[model samples]
Target: MENNMTNKLPKISEAELEIMKVLWSNSPQTANEIIEELEDTMDWKPKTIRTLINRLVQKEAVSYHQDKGRMYAYFPLVSQENYLQVETKSLLQRFCGAAFKPLLVNFLKEEKLSSEDINELKRILDEKTEENKRKDR
Candidate 1:
């Protein structure tokens, strides 16, 4: 199912990630549309972009349907949030021995958080605590 597919997500390179970002912003884009968007920010040629698109397709991260006259519109098969969740778990496993508390502590200690950001974090923690309490009952 969807969970199994996510567990097997292909490893995406940095360059491939840039292509995914564009698709994530707006989907069902033709190759030319993707090229145009990236041309403004990236130094890569259109062919290079096309190659990256092909690679993503091969990786099953992207899927395409023929638009018109041999042209195709591509869309992401994987959601950005799902990909981020997997990547975050992998990162935690690799760096923090899969201990989430240390990672949270490190980030809270090292990174500057706005008052609003801190409040949001507190809200999320409170919600989780409440959910756990209800489950234990």
Candidate 2:
């Protein structure tokens, strides 16, 4: 069942992503542990947090396990990278005519990056370039 659910990606809301973040960082957290983790950062009530968790479960983005104590431990069914790929595709289609360069240029123009960040991007680009060259041969 879990394997089947993984093949279908769900559209996640920003609020739901917050709950997922908590789970992604540490799996199988109870509802209370999730609330505690986000309490300082989120200005939401316990009921609201639980509602989001419920929504995620319904969407198959999360699933619960029956622990030894008969308590339900919630864990993320969807991975963070997979969700990011969906979001990136959505953004590119919406704003950049599905073009990579325009989206990248827009981000570069808007955000200020540290030298380390720039170097890392350069390294990624260089690796991609090498892969493309190898494919051409």
Candidate 3:
């Protein structure tokens, strides 16, 4: 993990994640812009969206800067990749006894993986295996 990802990140709720997704797709959007983008998909009121934004700001997961006279543009402080890493690690620790193989096997057995997906997983595992071999030398 990078240095920025090493620190504990503030927990983000599912609703808050919706706002973050919009910001992640395109950064520094005003509250109104975010609300507009989500309006078609979400039934939330503008005020409710604003409240979620406020919570994210308070959590330090999002920050804003004055874009024009009164409007502020908001962006995510946390990267999507970093957040996923933390969440994946937490899930593994909580339910998988911190073991990766069992979880991976379970997913492989349960999920309907396409040929491309299986090939990709094989390639990744092969690369990791070679890297570990070199390190052990």
- Best candidate, TM-score-wise? 1
Write down the TM-score for model 2: 0.80
- Report how far residue 7 has shifted in candidate 2, in Å: 7.2
TM-score per candidate:
0.84, 0.80, 0.82
> What's the true lDDT of residue 71 in model 2?
76
Q: Each candidate: what lDDT?
A: 0.93, 0.89, 0.92
Model 3 residue runs over 4 Å out of place are: 1-4, 109-123
Number of clashes in model 1?
A: 0
Q: What lDDT score is found at residue 3 in candidate 2?
A: 45
Which digits, one per residue and each the tens of the lDDT, describe model 2 over residues 57-89? Answer: 999999999889887799998998887777777
lDDT of 3: 0.92
Ranking by lDDT: 1, 3, 2
| Residue range 1-137, candidate 1, lDDT tens digits | 87897799988989999999999999989999999999879989999999999999999999999966889999999889989988998988898895889888889999999999999999999999999999999
lDDT comparison, 2 vs 3, better candidate: 3
